[model samples]
Target: MPNSSEHPCRITIGDDGPLLVEGPVEVTCADGTVAVSDRFVVALCMCRRSRMYPWCDTSHRRRTQPGEKSRRDTG
Candidate 1:
């Protein structure tokens, strides 16, 4: 079987933030790695700007200084 989500999960998407998943949840990365969280809720990084890769640390909220361009703005 193809390696992908086979079951359903309740995920909440933000306009410019991480995906919120109610925990405890288990996640499998594209690299064949896995991560889990037993917290009441989990924030999965969508911007990939998090130091906590796979998990969000509100890094997406970081603002670039004047004259500095952000990655998302470049695309």
Candidate 2:
């Protein structure tokens, strides 16, 4: 998790894929590591294909086409 001073950000799960995280957040990994960024807004990788894990690499787009199998159990 990011520092509380960062003010945090809002993450919205798109209907397709790719979580949209908007600014002021300090996104952290499973190990409690935080991402270094000078900016506020950032798009995180939810599909787990990003060379920059936790950041969007557009892999989700490939997994979610018009008629592809949905791997995520949103429920």
Candidate 3:
């Protein structure tokens, strides 16, 4: 459901990361599934490694330098 808005939604792209989308987004997956979020902003997973699927669980941050901590799943 969508209502008339004065401002259009905004979407941002990074060189290497998930997509940054404006608040309260609804995304339709390839399987005809719908993913929804109510946060002020949402990071849509670009990498298919997210455990949360369309939502980003920071699983894309597997590349860490030496001595740096990795955000990849450890559990």
**Cα TM-score per model:** 0.68, 0.56, 0.71
Model 3 weakest 10-residue run by lDDT: 1-10
Model 3 misplaced stretches (Cα beyond 4 Å): 1-6, 64-75
Clash list (residue pairs), candidate 2: 23-40, 45-54, 45-55, 45-56
lDDT of 3 by residue, 1-75 (tens): 233476667779998779998878879999999988888789998998999989888888657677677665365
Please list the residue runs of candidate 1 whose C-alpha ends up more than 4 Å from where it truly belongs after superposition. Answer: 1-9, 64-75
Per residue, candidate 1 scores C-alpha lDDT tens digits across 1-75 of 112477445679979899998788778988988998888779999998889878999999968887797676765
Clashing pairs in 1: none
Measured on C-alpha atoms, candidate 1 has an lDDT of 0.82
C-alpha lDDT score of every prediction, in listed order: 0.82, 0.69, 0.82
